[model samples]
Target: MSEVTDLVEMLEKTGIPMSNELIEALLRTEPSDFTDFPLESFWHDFPVPFLVTDSGVTKTISAPHMIVTMLHHLELDEGLHVLLMGSKGGYLATLIDIICGHGGKVTIIEPHDEIAEHTSNVLERRKQCGLIRVLGKEALEDPAWDRDVDRVLFTGSIREIPDFVELLIEEGGFILGPFGGRIQQRLMKKEWQGGAWLETDLGGVVFGPMDIRESERGFPDPLFIADEFEDALILISSVLGENSEEVYRLERLVESLRELPPGLPEITSSFTEEEIIEHPVIELLMTEAEWLNELWPTFVDILGFDLEGIVPDLEEPLFGKRHADFTP
Candidate 1:
């Protein structure tokens, strides 16, 4: 296969969306001439498109810019501790090693024994062990590692952000990862604050699932909140009023939320407290008798939509109860 074909084949597995610009950028690289460093071999040719390309001797094009762009929203500085969950080929982890700079620390967690060993060897050759620590074990149960990590970047898809990660970040610390499944893949950033989390959907992208298998049984399946659904609810609720069939759709929509699959691209939620407050949909929904009641209003409020009304007595006949009587 041609180099471009080979690179594309490698990147295909990552499941990240690629534009023509990204593809063209990667096609220009001379993978054969990449450094003898093993990890360098795993770097995909820039899959970015519409960029100039030339053939020449081996020259290094740093991906820190790309990596930083991927992680642009995150705040980093000296003394910050970072956890790189599911460090796979170590491409992203290596970039973090560079950006963390001196005195900063990065811990790479990988479960696949072979890849873990290979990554360990590669880091050892690069003499990056001082700044980067490779863990060939489970990240979830590691009690010795600092829980107060400044950031956690899961290069793979996560069905949910692990509670361990929640404990790791200081108040106001940020976490970035891909969540959902095949069609719902997206990048999400979350910030911890006083007793709550402020989450923003950065946009959509592809990624792979973490290799580690969960030992716990009966965990909920992953379900994604779609941007389209959120927008649809707002549009229908606003223009159609709370009594319209759209209200039923919105209620069913919220009820249908399932645990999202790992590696799904990020998507916006209809119930976003932020969007509803800024949009006109909440007001229209608030005018209705069914929606104006407490249970629904509280749900809207917790999601960040503000409307004045008496709280409803929310109950699911089949399930017997609901969790957020006072969410909003």
Candidate 2:
């Protein structure tokens, strides 16, 4: 059996809800280049896909559900031409193949020549070929990819949304990928409306790497503040419309405060837990804000020039320290 079929069988045995035989039937016939067992680093915790890298081989985790979620959100169907950049082990591409079937076309652009060759050979040997294609090229210079696709997917992160992506879409096509860095990403779709693009940010997510520009080294701080306050505000606004209950609470909070504060510390201190719980939108704001606050600190600690911000002994909260609060 091909490595792809073997993997599907393994996932099925692990209760991942997939059928190896069914998947094999759907796939195009291709030969297996991988005869020896793939090697995974000892540090890996999950079944990360692997590729034959020049520097011995590297493995990384991939979220199958995450891709499915993006596809469903885009309302993707057959007939859509998709461009996938940064092929990760061809596992994700296999899933997409099932979804797109033979009617839809998927072209994968990979920079790693060895990885490209392995994936290309496997697909060609499997008899489930033709509907899928592969190319070994740098994403930064691919002029043909500019605005020529119905949906563009970047498995890796991008420092900035490429102009080529805008050219690929046909005024209404959607593109999804990591916007900032590989550390964290928010799945976003841009719709061409009027004369400009309208952005819809889904939420914070963790993902595998992408075809990043050589100049792109670290995460680019987004224009909006990365603190708890901004997180809450953005989430509440996105969920409830202008006249919703959440919006009213935000307005009330703004009105009560004399001036805008710099960080979440000020906002949290200003209002009591009771006040926050009573507000319609403050609940969601609080949740997202707290999450962002927890995330930003870690990102900073890891990426900051001076490692002084690092929390050395970080541990999960001991929430139930005083289990029984009533006096005996």
Candidate 3:
């Protein structure tokens, strides 16, 4: 088998599912194009988070799992305009260039000067300069930065969404990022709709914080809170008994939700109220409602939304309960 095929099979063996399309993308691209280290060392599925420097200061490249998961959330396509808030050695950005192919365009904003310069040099050498634009850190703070993108992905965590980001996305465009404080962080997806931003939780994620200076310029209220509800449920279920039928059911439900397509409406519309409350996952959460109630309010307060209104309550019997309670 080819090295790419071997890598794909190895990842699958480790329980990281890979769609054929994603496999093809990886197969066609070279890891050395992004990583400073030898690609042979990463021939198998492995956690490869590492530090690189542009001018003696250190910056991080995220782990492979996080990169793949974020890409899955982006649901990229040819010709789409994408904006990336952070460039970590330009590894993920290069992978995106491979997927977007010829027609797509990528605009990247990197805060560190040396890192951006290094990334630009690499892209130019790889003949990908035509596909991507690397901008200075101050560009994001500029009111005039392009905001017509179809998709946005943040490589780092942030306490609140940046105002410029909100203005940059075209209607129906979505942004994905690990959002929350150091103690709690979850990957959040937000889309612009009619004039408001609708948000959803894509489960938990751990990422480093955004540059402190940039984060200070973010909006007052984050659109969504970091969600750890499902994680809590899993822990609670395990303590209750790992082999129980209910625990198995909850595990399946969590997996299903994690693999669901991005966007709040797409996920919420897929299931009915009967399908939701009756699901083992929902039942498990309800059984531990008192515990969840204690945790839910803090998330609700951070998001500035009513948790009860968003989630389906046993008392409410709503249609989008699955999304309402857990995601947004």
Candidate 4:
């Protein structure tokens, strides 16, 4: 969103920039199959909890909007090598697998053994295990490779962006994740510009801790989290442009929407006319920009689909192929 020199050049390497193809890819691979949670939980546009560690910390797959947003900016293309810090239920990995094709490679570092195993089983079941390698943090000790990976992604929150991440990427590569304090973070982007990395604030998100043990930091301070967005609340402000009266008005609406309980209620499963208009998230999106109104409904339809019998196009990766992928 900046006109600065480094950020400008970094944007040129971006691929897919929208969520439609990602949604369609998701339909081909059932999200329910990747999680132990019930189907009801898997179908909503919210962070669905699938694993709880012995530490009593719960892990969740990011909401659909957040997933699409992260992958959208990740700039997936065929033949890329991506290093993922979190497994993301193998859901995100699988999506990456879809986009990267046979020439691509993914190395997922999942610190939790249970999650790592679960992700491996699902990928093997889907026959995608061949394209990805699931390992623990120990793998970082020896990141031996001839060239740098094209991208690095983190699905959870980190207190701050780690310095060592830059070593794992090439000149044009980038790292995308939530970087900030517990319970709230700015989704920051760090792009390697050959000389140095340039950063961009992708907006706010409240992903789970990078380590379940991070709960020791104490509960979220409302003072800090008051500005955070949960589930699809991030979407309301994601594409809003430069600081202006319109942006402020939308921010006010986001404040109101944030007051609602996290995750969509069961009513969203079966949308009636009254329910669509009355839904706070939908209202916020439709009111933010007239064109964006279509996006929310489109997501509703995609999330409501039956994934049982659909088949995805494995020969060709769909991400970054859309017209929107052409520009920064």
**Going through the candidates in order, what is the number of backbone clashes in each?**
37, 22, 4, 1
Instruction: List the global CA lDDT of all models.
Output: 0.52, 0.51, 0.64, 0.62
**Regions of candidate 2 where Cα sits further than 4 Å from its true position:** 1-47, 138-146, 215-328
Candidate 2, residue 89: the lDDT equals 57
lDDT of 3 by residue, 1-328 (tens): 3765677677667666556656667777666666666555466444453345644545656655666778888988878888888777777777787788788888888877777887788777776623888998677777666667999898877777877778788989998998875446889999889988798999987776676354333211111121333444444454456785545654554565455333333114456767655554344445555434544454344333343432455563322222223445
Model 1 C-alpha lDDT per residue in residues 44-76, reported as the tens digit of each score: 544221112143212222342334346455555
Rank by TM-score, highest first: 3, 4, 2, 1
Off by over 4 Å in 4: 1-21, 212-328
Candidate 2 local Cα displacement, residue 241, angstroms: 34
Over 4 Å off, model 1: 1-66, 137-139, 213-328
* TM-scores for the candidates: 0.49, 0.52, 0.60, 0.58
Decide which is better by TM-score, 1 or 3.
Answer: 3
Q: How high is the lDDT of residue 248 in model 2? A: 65
Candidate 1 lDDT score at position 84: 80
- Cα RMSD for candidates in order: 16.1, 12.5, 15.2, 18.0
Q: How many residue-pair clashes does candidate 2 contain?
A: 22
What ranking of all candidate models by lDDT puts the best one first?
3, 4, 1, 2
Q: Which candidate, 1 or 4, has the higher TM-score?
A: 4
